[model samples]
Target: MAGTFGNCGALSFFLTGYLQRNPNASAAEVVRYLDAKCQGQPDQSKRQHPQIRARYALNGPLRL
Candidate 1:
C-alpha cells in the first residue's frame, strides 16, 4: 500500500470509492470535493500531488 501511494497515492482509490457511492457525480465534481476535503492534508509522502490527483479523478469511470 505504501509503495502504491509512493507511485500514485490514494487519490485513485478514494475517487473510485466516491464514484461507486455517487454514480451520478461528475469527475470534476469529485475532484473539487476531494480538493476541499483533502486541503491542507500532509503530502510529505509525495503521493497526492494536485495534478496527479486530478488526473486520477478525471480519468475515472464516467456515468454514461
Candidate 2:
C-alpha cells in the first residue's frame, strides 16, 4: 500500500541500500553523501536529512 509506494521509489531504494552499507556513518554524513551524489552540496540539500531520517524510522532499518 502506501508504505510500499514510498520505499520502492528509486531514490529511496537506492538511498536505503547505500545507507545500509554505511551504517557507521552519522545521519549528517549520510546527508552530505546523498547531497554530493545528487549533484548538489550538503547545505543545499540540508532538508533531506530529516526526511531521510523520518523515512528510515518509518520504514525500519534497511536489512542487508
Overall lDDT per candidate, in order of appearance? 0.56, 0.51
List candidate 2 stretches off by more than 4 Å. Answer: 1-7, 40-64
Find the candidate with the highest lDDT and give its number: 1
What digit string (tens of lDDT, one per residue) describes model 2 on residues 9-43? 43465578778899788888877765555553222
Candidate 1 per-residue lDDT, tens place, 18-44, comes to: 889999998789978777646644444
Superposed Cα deviation of residue 7, candidate 2 (Å): 6.5
lDDT score, residue 61, model 2? 24
Residue 55 local lDDT, model 2: 68
Question: What does candidate 2 score on TM?
Answer: 0.43
State the RMSD for candidate 1.
Answer: 9.2
CA-RMSD of model 2:
10.8
Question: Clashing residue pairs, candidate 1?
Answer: none
